[model samples]
Target chain A: MSCLETIQSYSLRSIGIGERLLPRSDFTLCEQVVLIGSGMIWNVYFGLMALTTGFFLATAIALGKGSANPWLRKPAEWFIFLFRGSPLFIQFFFAYFLFLNLKGAYPFFDPFTAAWLGALIVLFLNTGAYSAQIFYGALQSIPKGEVEAADAYGLSGWSRFRRIVWPTMLRLAWPAYTNEAIFLFHATTLVYFSGFPAWQQRGDALYYASYFADKTFNPFVPYPILAGYFILLTLVIIGLFGLVNRRLNRHLPANARSKMKLRLNLIR
Target chain B: MFSYCSDPDTLERLWWLSCYLTTGVHFSFYLSFLKVIGILAVTAPVALAFGFAGAMSARSQILPVSWLGKAYIAIVRGVPDIAFFLFFVIALDQGFEWLRHQALCPDWTDPIRQGNDFLVCPQAKLPLGTAPQAVHQAYAFALAVMTFALVFGAFVANVIFGAMRAVPKAQLETAEAYGMSPRQTFWRILVPQMWVYALPGLSNLWQVLIKATPLLFLLGIEDVVYWARELGGTKTARFTAYPHGDWRMWYFLALLVFYLFMTWGSEKVLSRIMARLTRGQATTGGEAQRKGAPA
Candidate 1:
């Protein structure tokens, strides 16, 4: 098939849209690129949806963790510790099995056995716990001077937080938050491999890559294609976050500002 | 295990439970835990070695060597490691066999890629077709270990590289002023001092590495997850000595608790080591320790 024809047939192959059957024999470069790129839709979906939802929940959890009230702080602390301490792999398994039992008890909950809801839930909670810890650390590290300035301006309650504390918290946390986001994207690949079944052969990038690899017995072509796509995706993320970081630091003098670069040192 | 387990049918709840726990499958389950530990023990040092080399190479004065190291670290960071694990195992296996094929059967040229089959000469089969089952298992395990090391080593290199950079440039300059050679400066001032800076990242990496051991199951090594699924699946009374309902939930719960305990214990030990390392250093923890001591 021509590259255009190949693209038309395999572009949405991951969600079972274009092609009924994956290319089985005579694997071509066009097929590898198109199919793997198609599978990336799920990766982007999982990462974006989970990150969007997890962001708000993480903020709340971070606030709770930093709260003076033990009722709030203790549970938040344990939640962060539990999720952050364990591997995402185990969390996926444990969540899957727990959901399995739950489904057995309540037949209505069987939807949790599949990737969409079940894996998303695990990714959501797991990323929330991780990001919450990052935000908590950022919240603590917010400059005393900033809060003091707010107090001097007669700011209190929500006004004080909105005008002063919140911005600084986000600014301080932005770098770490960026790291958390990258790691979450990487972690999304683990969803299918865990206990959650991929319904209708609908799987993510890695899933489809494995499928192609298994089918063709050629790992060299497909895996690197996925890797290249991920690198590009990661660069896009870095670029987007870099813009936000710049905006956050915009008011500061140029000499005082630090550029946000991809520091692979931090792993979730 | 118990002497009171005389009559099999009359053996009620406790005795039956004891026998069931001591069954061959349970032994395999326990051995799987050791496998997890064994992977960690083997992978940790090997990964560290790879990381050290990677870090050193990245810091190399030569542009190409540094670029190669930097690429290794960056490439793994973006992509999900599970993808690499899934991809590399088969790729490495094929790569090995293909190399063997080229070497052992140079003249015999039926295309290696015939339709979908990766056909190799009989002699080029890794472990050979006639090799024992244990050999195949060992080969798979070795592949899993190498994949783990390759992926995790990149992360470690990133950490170690940052830590190496974090070691104050002044320390190296001081060593230089004291008449130390370039190699001596690196050995005496840089490498030794970098660990203290590196410990936090390395400790975090260590925990991540521990958590990542379960991916061995995905790599087709029969680790704990495999055992859990195997032992926890539903079984009819006719199929086994001790038949049970689907108990995967309980099995996974056990795994969860085991992991939680392992991580909790490691955190405790790491904190103690952190405390020890922080003593007499220039950081906040060191300052705190110095202040807390009696004058």
Candidate 2:
């Protein structure tokens, strides 16, 4: 089939549309590209929703970890440690079983077994924990003078944080936050592998790529195609984060603001 | 297991669990914790060598050699590492087999790539397809170790490369003024100082390496996650001596605590090492140490 015909047939294939069965024999480059590209839709969905939702929770948890009260501080500290310390692969497995038991106990939790909601929750918590640590570090490093100035001007708790602290902390945290977003997006590839069945072969890019590899016994084509898609996605993330970074740091004297570059070191 | 544990179905809760925990597979499950530690112990030094080579080459005066080093650092790190793990295990296995195919089957004219089958002479099969179980496990493990090393070495190279640059340019210049060769300067001046700068990144990388050990399950090693699933799944009475309901949550919880203890202990040990390394250096930690030296 022509590339256009193939796209039409498999554009929504990851979500289980337009085709019931995947290509089984005589695999084409076009088919691999289309199906894998189609699977990227799920990656985008998981990353986007989890990142957006996780952002607020991350901020709250960061604040909690920084708080003076041990009641607030200890739980937040443990939450971050529990998620950050363990492998996210095991987190998915652990969460699946927990949800399965919960579903058995309550009929309302039946939807929790499906990958879409259940897996999204895991990614959300995982990213939230990681980003929280970055934010906590950033928050701690906020200059003493800034908070002192706000306090001297009589800016109290919430407003002091809102006005004097939050923006600066974000500015400091932006580079690492950008790294976290890129990692989280890349991490979406793991959900399918982590006990969360794709349900009718509806999986992310690596899933489809591996499917083709299993069928054709040729690792060369499909995996590289998947990597190409990821490279594009990674670039898009960097570009978007870079743009926001520039805008956020625009007011800082050029030398004072940190420049965001793509750094893949030590994502956990 | 006590005498009362002989009939587990008839036994009460405490006795039933005591007997169940002593099963033969549970012993294997406990040993797998050491396997995770084994990977960390072996991979750290091997990956360090790979990183040192990568960083050294990237710093080389020769352009192509430098580019090779830079590309190695970039490509493995640019993508999610798990993808590399998935790709290389199959690719490396196939590559070894293909080489053996060429070497062992010179008179054979049949194509190795026949449709979907990677057909090769029987001798070309890795582990000879007739090797014992231990050899098969060892081969799979060797593949896992290589994949872990290659992926992590790139990250380490990035850290080392930055650390090398962070060394004062004046220090290298002094060595040059003293008529030291570039190689001598690197060995004496740059190599000694890079660790002080590299420690923070390496410590962080070490934590990441710890968390990443569970991905061994993905590489097809029957690591902790595999054992958890296998042992925690519901067991019918007919299947074995002990039958139980699904218990994966508890198994994974134990795994979670094990990792947390590891990371917590790692933090303590790394901090002590950092303090020792920071002595008489130029970084903040060293500055503080020098200032507080009277104690």
Candidate 3:
């Protein structure tokens, strides 16, 4: 097949759009690229869904962790510890089996056995725990002067948090959180490889890449393509987070403003 | 195994449980945990050495060497490390075999890349085609360790590079003033002081390294995850002792608790080490110590 024809056929192959059968032999460069690029749709979906939903839970968790009441604090602390302390690979396995058991009991959980929902849930909780810790540190280090200044303006409770505490926490946490976001996206590649089976070969980018590698007995080509796709994805994440970082730090002087630096804050 | 374990069907309930847990496969499962620890023990220092060399090269005055180091660090940061793990094991195996083929069969002219095959000479095969199972396992384990070292080394390099920069410039200048050569300043002054700055990142990397141990299964090693799935799968009465239905979840739960304790214990130990390292340093940790503030 021509390169264009190959693209048309396998472009959405990951989501079961065009192709039913994968290429068996004589794997062309174009076919490998198209199929692997097609699989990126799942990666994007997992990362976007988990990161968006995880953001809200992370905020709650951060606040809960900082709350003075033990009723609130203890559970939040343990939640972070449970998710953060264990390897995410094991979490995927455990969660899959848990969901499978739940499916046995309730018909409503039937869909959770598939990679889409089950793996997404694991990613969501994992990122939530990690980012919550980052946010908690930011919340703690929120300059006391900012809270005092807000108190002077009669800002109290929710408004006080909305006005003074939240923005500063985000501002302080944005850099580390960006790192978390990138890693979460990276972590999404683990979904298909984990316990949750990818229904009908509709797996993620790494999945397709590995498929090509296995078929051709060549690692150099397909793995690099996968890496190239991820590097692009990482850049996109940095660009998006950089925009938010700017908005959060907009009021500060140009020189005094915190710049987003992409560093490895190595959490699994 | 207990003497009563001979006939599992005739055993009491508690005895059945005890015998079940003590099966030979279970012992292998237990040994897999040690295998993980062994990998960590071996990989840590080797990766640190790789990282130190990488950091030094990145900070080198020579342009090409610095770029090479920077590229190594940057690539790992962007790519999912599982990709590297998957890629390197196969790639390295083929790479070694290819080199061996080239040396051992110089007169051979057929292309190695023939459609779906990597046709290296038989003599050049990793562990050789005739090698024993033990040799093959050891070869695979060595490759896994090398892959882990290469990937984690880049991460450590990034940490060490930043830590080197974070060490106060004035201290280096003072070393220079004391008639110390540039190499002396780097070895005697910079390397010694950089550890305190590097400690936080290194500790974080250690936790990451721990979490990453499960990926050893992906490398085809019969690690804990492998044994868990094997032992926990459904077994009918036709099979040997234990007849259980899908106990994989519990096995994974046990593994999860194992990792949780491992990481938590590491946290406690790392914090103590951090305290010891920061005792008299000039950083905020040291300042807090001077003020008798609790960490």
**Highest-DockQ candidate:** 3
Give candidate 3 misplaced runs (Cα > 4 Å): A265-267, B291-295
Every model's DockQ: 0.60, 0.69, 0.76
TM-score of chain A of 2: 0.97
Weakest 10 consecutive residues of candidate 2 chain A by summed lDDT: A259-268
Query: Which candidate's TM-score is highest?
Result: 3
Cα deviation in Å at residue B132, candidate 2? 1.4
**Model 1 complex DockQ against the native:** 0.60
Which residue pairs come into collision in candidate 2?
none
Q: CA shift at A193, candidate 1, in angstroms?
A: 1.1
Q: Give the per-residue lDDT of model 3 (tens digit) for A1-268.
A: 9999999889999999997999998889999989999999999999999999999999999999999999999999999999999999999999999898888889999999999899999999999999999999999999899999999999999999988999999999999999999999889889888888878899899999998888888999999999999889988999999999999999999998887877854438
Error of 3 at A83 (Å): 0.8
Off by over 4 Å in 2: B1-4
Q: Is the docking of candidate 2 incorrect, acceptable, medium or high quality?
A: medium
CA lDDT of A32 in candidate 1?
83
Ten contiguous residues with the weakest lDDT in model 2 chain B: B1-10
State which candidate, 1 or 2, has the greater DockQ.
Answer: 2
